[model samples]
Target: MPSLLSSAIAHPARNQHLLLLQSSVAQTCLPVLRDVVQRSMERAREKTILFCLLYPPLSFLDKASRAQTDRLLVVDRTTYVPGYSDGLDFNDDVASFLRSAIMDSIQSSSLNIVIDSVDTLLSDINSVSATTRILSELLSIVRTRGGTSRLIIHVLAPCPLLPILTQTRFSPSLTHLIAHPTALLTHIASAYLTLPPPLSPPEKFWGVFIPISERHYESEKLVYGSAGEGSGLQDFVVEILVRGGADATGRRRGVERELEGWSPALGGPCEVRELDSLKSLCSEKPATEMQIVPDPTQNLPFNLNLTQEQAKSRAQVPLPYAHEGKPPVQASMPAAILYDPDSADDLDDDDPDEDLDI
Candidate 1:
């Protein structure tokens, strides 16, 4: 069976779009994009248009796709892209520009969009609702196209726009369900992957000492093109909304989390692996599901697991629900409930009290 990572990948119409919550590393999407684009080519025999905010990487795209990669009008260093109206900015009409680009670039067979730097886009756009709305419109457009069109939205999570979501104790689902920017994206995308930032020195201490802080960050110290704490990608927390399972509100109605390991190859894409523990489950007898929330009574000063003698003794003791002081109930002589009638239902209240002694 395919790993969770593979299953969560953006498929044709089956899984149209993906919202990737990336680490600080910008190039975390490169490996997956290579694989997805390759799959698109093999399956559809067509080119995928990449609408990248940064310059597109050369490894996957053709000369044409590369030329059109950074198609969004941008001024070199400011909010306004020069060559457009003097004071107008990309942010002023980002959604319209994307709609025009997508409509123009679409062809007979298929079209795929890879937004490489949604972090920067969100930073510049500065409105979570607007960003989400634009993506939804694009999703609707692709769905109506009646072909293998898909959108793979790859974005880093840390920016001024997101308010340092990584530093918080909040779960991704909580953030997505709240007013946070992640909500609509997670709701709309068929698959959502979180490349969580690695634990810093303090966070990794395993309760040795109270951490003064959990994560530390510095811009200049970041090492690009590597998967270490501050550099590149890591394992993914994959959440897939089954296709066609959304409700009338345009939100998937369930929640689950699956994790798998990934090792990015040098100068290439990546490989995913199921954990070592799951492989041994085949031979083992099927058991009750692994508990998600652990038993609250565990890991206390007293031992919880019983020895054989303790268990046997405990079993012998009578209890209200399971056992009584007498012999066990049997099929032939089952326990019964009886109500005695008092003297054929006599009803002489004053005289009966006086005659009770006699």
Candidate 2:
């Protein structure tokens, strides 16, 4: 079976997605996720979002990051409630209020909603049913808007009330598989993404493996395009410039060599029907075509790029105010390294961040 990475790169303008994000925020995959959201917006030509529940350095916290922030809408439900605190009660009114706000925000254009940890709410008595109800209402609202809106919701608890679930529950024996984890995820998420737990010891540079729901195959089709006759060949080749590595010419150079050779017609306006036919041909006989090598001279070390220097200098760090002359204010450290496993076991099996007030 093809991987989620294949599916995601194939279809960027999907209407809905249910991603399993890790509780930590320091993971390097944030850049990849942001890239996906940006590309989705580019394809749809509308506003996009990254809704967060518990995490710091949220993309939309200040003016400096506001442009990126404007594209995101965050919901910090952690403060209102704490982790694993089963003492509180679910306020239907508050849940309804938040749901309305989210619906309004998504009404204007294509948006992506994310609920970081559903397990947080699982602690409250009857929390699963209540949250499921609210989320169902929110899904209805998004569907009514008629744009390509998606969601990357997270689940921390073992069992959920939704059908579109990302993580799977444990099984002691064949009998344990008799009961379903929950339908709440499926009811809200059109595609489910899961990740497996850490089985081996942590490596220096940890990477996550995600398996998106197989439903992707049934949900959409991939179209291929061809260069119009007599058009320049430059339009057929996509130039990729990575932040590192030696630059070379022709195909086997730079980062482009890392990607499997699959070039779609992306230069200009092409007939969709023709693109569809080309895709069918490729699928039937992928080896019949000759491999066109990508041009090199793209990769360069980040420290060598002046633009990168400026970015590194401006990165957020604790510094004294020019006038105060006192000590600098304490700044919180970056988020933890986390992974969102695309698997049934990654869902809400326990409520870890649901006790504090929102």
Candidate 3:
């Protein structure tokens, strides 16, 4: 998949922005989480604060630099539960703890709040309304402060809330997926980005960055233009390739690269009719054919050369700026006279003397 950091950077957040990164599998999101943390660390000197609600736990952050970790304030996901042995509760309010963390981060620097997975949090809380309220409050806080806060969230794809009809058969339409957890997150987010599922098993590591809203896609399309003719929304697909390697600590690391020429259309199942309609609308209009008209004077063998006198007269003619009646205003003295010390005495002599006090 494409590097989440690079994609996020490309779609820069304005002041008080919320960003969502939705995918089906939680593991697929790890690379992006690491990348964002590292980027936050690099910019920490600029007073960037990162608050991470790590559902997968602190071990996921081990690959991040010490500086990155120092800049981060994390809330263990277990704390959200009331009776869990490892849970940390203050006044029995997980909402309060989250608010406090956000406020503290804002006080120090611009906040970058990342929640590993809202779906997991919702499940833990077992109250969608309560979780939604908390999220709404946090978003409001960021907006009211007028400080640019990038709230990055990961949501599971094929969301659990999506109704399953039978064990073998599934809802094949996008309408069924609209009520997914990520969809709810989308309603509040400033930008909704999706990491589309891979095409083939071999290409499973590759994904495309797609904007959640058509309006946003249109605005971007106007600015960047279509990628190619007949390409449809696939023209805007930014391919992200996930690679595995070792960090300085010899721990297995995952990194992302932005590849070229890959289209989202090639990956995952989509509503064909909707895509077809959009393709028809966005397709480039063909150029109109027109006959070239010959210049009226092209074949005329008229005198093309000007006489010396005529040329001289043309050259001598005053330009539009040079009025015929008024002399041009001289704002400064001649270079020679201005620079010459001898001319200074002459200029002084020309000045009328005033009566001196006796």
Residue-wise lDDT of candidate 2 within 335-354, one digit each (tens)?
55445567676576777768
Give lDDT: candidate 2, residue 60: 28
lDDT per residue for candidate 3 within 69-142, as digits (tens), equals 44555555444454655544322443555466555554555655566676776666677667666655555654
What overall lDDT goes with each candidate model? 0.42, 0.35, 0.42
TM-score of each prediction? 0.43, 0.34, 0.39
> Which candidate achieves the best TM-score against the true structure?
1
- Backbone N/Cα/C clashes per model: 2, 40, 6
Clashing pairs in 1: 74-81, 75-81
Instruction: Please estimate how well model 1 matches the true structure, expressed as its whole-model Cα lDDT.
Output: 0.42
Q: Ten residues in a row with the worst lDDT in model 3? A: 171-180
Model 1 residue runs over 4 Å out of place are 13-15, 25-27, 45-47, 59-109, 159-256, 266-358
Give per-model CA RMSD: 14.4, 32.7, 20.9
lDDT of 1 by residue, 229-275 (tens): 33334332222323232333446634433323344432221221232
Q: Who is ahead in TM-score, 1 or 3?
A: 1
Judge candidate 3 at residue 357 and give its lDDT.
Answer: 57
